[model samples]
Target chain A: MKERKSEGNEVKVRWYGYIVLVIAILFFSGVFTAFEGPLKALDFTNLAGDFGKLGTLEEGAGSLASNFRGTGGAGAKDAWMFAMTLFPTVMFALGVVKVVEYLDGLKAAQKLLTPLLRPLMGLPGISGLTLIASLQSADAGASMLNTLAEEGEITEKEKNIFAAFQFSGGGTLTNYLSSCAALFAFMTVPILVPLAVVIAFKIVGANLMRIYLNKVCKQ
Target chain B: MDKKVTPKKTVVDAFVEGARNGFGISANSMAPNVMFAFVLIQILNLTGLSDILGVIFQPVMGIFGLPGVAATVLIASFLSMGGGVGVAASLYSSGLINGTHISIMIPAIMLMGALLQYMGRILGTANVDNKYYPQLFAICFINAILSMFVMRLIVSL
Candidate 1:
């Protein structure tokens, strides 16, 4: 009975410790307002004007194509413009992530994360590779799991636990870059509170999934 | 224990390697989705479809602790992970939302990755028999919603 009580206390302390650590990280990351003040004061009229000019050029091309071919080229033109603008950024981000990995950054990252993640997630040290890969590239993470399964690095049981943790915890960097702009648009007190709640929920949700898989699924 | 150890690469080498790996992954997976999203958003913008969608989603936006106008970013973020970023950039570039809005939205967006769903699909492919996909999705979706609510509450205070 004393041991059980002590164990309970330990769990409670650990849980609260996790919460405090997460909150501290978020507060310090400046991820909350990396570009708030300057972006808000920018002159939008000129930017809109630039977009208008691009639109006009697109329109001109569409009219020319329609006059010659009797089919409006607006859709094609819009698609092309959008592709031209967004593709490079995605490519650039992907490239950066890859280079990070090829240089053994992920291996180093795995070593650093292994100590904390293994105990916290109840996963093996090898699982760190999958988690780190997931952060940069979701597909890579999945592939890593598959490879591990093939190599028998982990049992079917371990695989399920790994899956639960990865599913809940993967894809941090990509998500951040993708949503940074949208978040900047509606920054307000009301918005901030919900955002913080979501952050907490994500952390707790992932941890809960880890615990459930470990304790309940006795593969 | 005496296996020969490889020396650590320099920072520049690491950066270059990371870039290369990133390029390969992007080309294979992320690029196609990004293209699809870009095309979709462009068509929406041109045909004013986004505005129409914005109007439709306004009420739902309130439930999520966002303004009616902010629905555009939320929906965009959902459709194309980067769509929200584009919307935010446009709004900020246009001087529509202030710094406070930017601050609030950044963390919310950062924490809003569809990792749960993404992981579920990957695990499904791996033939892992534990059917926790629904539970995982629910946890992530609920967490995201709850986080947003809590963030709003804290910032409001």
Candidate 2:
């Protein structure tokens, strides 16, 4: 984590990053899905568009196209076909996420998260900031842990406990928000409630790991 | 004061780089994992394991005021969070589960979601010991189950 300051390099969070982050959130939220107007373009489902619908000659009378999957399919063959279709969605999403990162959008998020996660993670010093980075990306968090371990700043048991915290809701912010789009509209509670619970449980899970390592594993 | 020297790459280049990474993950990780899930589900159907599972899980699901079929959502989440939510949405639309159930499930799903993949991504990347993997997974399960109970209580209130 200290690597950032070695050459006096602190991340610059441009104002545009916040705007990009908001747009990114809306793009995935599916709010524009029902809009028939220009705002429909704001939605990922609308932006990716749809596969060509078969005309009267093929399936006829139906404006809705089932796309390539088509009806009953079983076993590996069907699985392959469906996975093929998912490629665009996953690729497009990460692509947008990448743009967000390049534009410092993730840093914009990190600035907000650092204060919250710092107290929750309870690391003594600079490492607290690194822990917050883990909330957005699993790789980033794990790498921070790896560095901390290498530096001997964290004990093995603490490392294991931290692993449990991260493993439970890996990439909590990005994965939760992006993947929860489908369930978001249907949720009766406010959006932040579930996310807050997930964070709380991540810590709960870490303590569970701590107990197991201390009492059961004894490793 | 000289402005910070930003990299010459434009946003479009960043997007392409990001998209390439996405393609790689889809091809390597997601495609195979999804295929594995699909085949596993098919085998469960063939062996009548799904029905057996439903019967077994119903009572546990009942504690949350959900149907036995809701177990599929949790199971899917264990494999992948998105998949779990997909299963929940489909079930909800079909009227098998209600809005309250989905609300209660949100945290539970996020807590346990994508463990199979994250084991490699998070722990392996962190260089955490191999022996700790099972216990860590168990912790996730414990957390998920506990959260559902809490969420159910909250929603009721």
Candidate 3:
């Protein structure tokens, strides 16, 4: 009975799923970043919000503004404070990801990605969901791919190529927004810039593996 | 056809579950890793090893438009992404590298992030042939270096 519902989920495509999926993409895409007021709510970084500054102790002549972590701190105590500041952002991003997944936003994307997966990554369309799953959880994706390999659904070359994508930047979505929040403040580019780079390289890395397998492996 | 009914999970519930996971991850993984990075940076600074590193890695890192000290972030990132970011943030705080350098280092950090850990988590679990592991590792390092070039171009623009 549980299997039936799970199958239905994979087959069913709700009309609202596409809409919410697009909204979710825009939310993470930084497209609405420049908008004002409530519109800014659509952007990830804006909704993640900023901390209150300590403000100037002196007049305009000598500005004294600093974050709650302050300045000139070193070692573990300083790292502790810095990490503390990051918790809220990570929490918000994960919470939103969960909310989107609950709404079937990611499944909607998986559906769309299924066809493109082949031409894009040299993967079969059936591996689309697993590839999407890899972005959220490395263990889950790896185990699922192993299942595919065990069942003889994917060829050895295909498994290796997919493994290449998963190896570098594994669990990308979770790790990037959550684990790498420390570098967010220092980044001069939009949040998506680095993410786009990582994703592009994941594909490139997989194709490079593909080239190696085709040319050298002789399998 | 008997269909078993399952209760729908509300959006709030989903968010709560994920947020709870975030708390656990931050406490267990991120916080300790960053603290470890901070201590590593301190040791490098106090031992005056950072300067020596700056001198040694200068030529290699300069190719990526990064300072020699920026090499530490990439090195730490190879072990754990959180540590790499911590090293980058620490360097930024010390005024060794600015926001532009951070932007350039961003993609490279995660492209090669947590490779040693994921070697088992990703490759071992997936059960890829052991013979290809060397090539797989090489591909990731190549991807990381290549991405830095792309990020450097974006930063310049």
Candidate 4:
């Protein structure tokens, strides 16, 4: 009897330890203190017109006006900058995806991801490539899934599930590493914490979407 | 596995085909979508229409700790990430928003950005029926809102 009681206590302690570990991970990932203190300290009303050595806010406004006035404005410049920064990455990622598809690399990826993703994502193994492509461009991922659906490798239901997954935060890596990452470069806080937190929530959102699709869109 | 000998294309052929497919999709679909959002937001900013929209959305955005002016950024983001980035950069450089705001807002923005094009180009190109577009969009939007709350919680902690 005493041995059994001790064994039960040990199991309880183990469970407590696991719970503590989970909380620790959450804390370290910045899930607990994400935007609170910083937001309270922000001055959102005044346009900081001259930040990071950029021209005054008035000049910026003028540039924005010029952009619309058909005189090369800040608006036009930013638009050009956006395209220059983003489209190349999109093109590169899409090209890589096409090559992977053409070479039948997806089959290998599917085989590897099936056992791992089946239980976690409720998706077929082949949809793994789609997930990875989504990290680059959601469009690429969606197109890949469509191709799979056309080949009859995945059903309409699975397509919806995969779409939900990709749709939640598509182009995650690309956006983070390029555009969003640039935004964070000058911040006081560490980038990893927010990155980890966002990724974790995206997974949650994706799985929630999977459950929703399963219940409502039964095929 | 019946590994049938598939006709192999040369390296140059594979590369060329992939490049064409990539460039074509971006130029045909993605580029137009991003450009549309970019131009529209610029027009709105220039015309001061964004301020009116910002006033309308202030209360809603305030609930999430965002400034009223964020309405314009959010609208632009809802159309494309490139637009979102452009707006965010302008706002940031102008001192309208700071790093903390950007950090908190980034996740939700990433999740919610590019709705119209994502639905029309990505899913449509996949040949999904038009009927499901609304439902899919709702799912993504809800997910983004939920992530916003999560981001808020993270920042607040």
TM-score of each: 0.56, 0.72, 0.95, 0.60
Q: Where does candidate 3 stray beyond 4 Å?
A: A1-10, A60-65, B1-4
Give the alpha carbon lDDT tens digit for every residue of A1-219 in model 2.
223441112445789888987887777666777888899988776776776654444365445436776546666776677667666766676677778888878776665554554356543344554556677788898898888878887778778878888999888866654566456657876556787789899988877776677788764
Model 2: residues >4 Å from true position, as ranges? A1-10, A35-37, A55-65, A132-137, A152-161, A172-200, A203-219, B1-7, B69-110, B113-138, B147-157
What order do candidates take by DockQ, descending?
Answer: 3, 2, 1, 4
**Candidate 4 CAPRI grade:** incorrect
How far does residue B54 in candidate 1 sit from its true spot (Å)? 3.8
Candidate 3, residues A57-81, lDDT tens digits: the string is 6555765536888778999999999
Clashes of each: 38, 0, 0, 13
Candidate 3's clash total is: 0
Every candidate's TM-score, chain A alone: 0.48, 0.68, 0.91, 0.48
Candidate 1 local lDDT, A57-158, one digit each (tens): 454454332112123223334323433343334444444444444544445545556776556655666666667666655567777887787888777666
Tens-place lDDT digits, model 3, residues B44-110:
9999999999999999999999999999999999999989999998888888899998899888888
* Residue A198, model 3, lDDT: 94
What is the two-chain DockQ of model 3? 0.81
Q: Rank the candidate models, highest TM-score first.
A: 3, 2, 4, 1
Put down candidate 4 lDDT per residue, B1-157, tens digits, no spaces.
4354778676467656655755565556444544565566677678987778778888998887877777666677787765675576556645667776676677777777777777765677677766666777777677667766767777777
TM-score of chain B of each: 0.62, 0.71, 0.95, 0.67
Q: Residue A93 CA error for candidate 3 (Å)?
A: 0.6
Worst 10 residues of 3 chain A by lDDT: A1-10
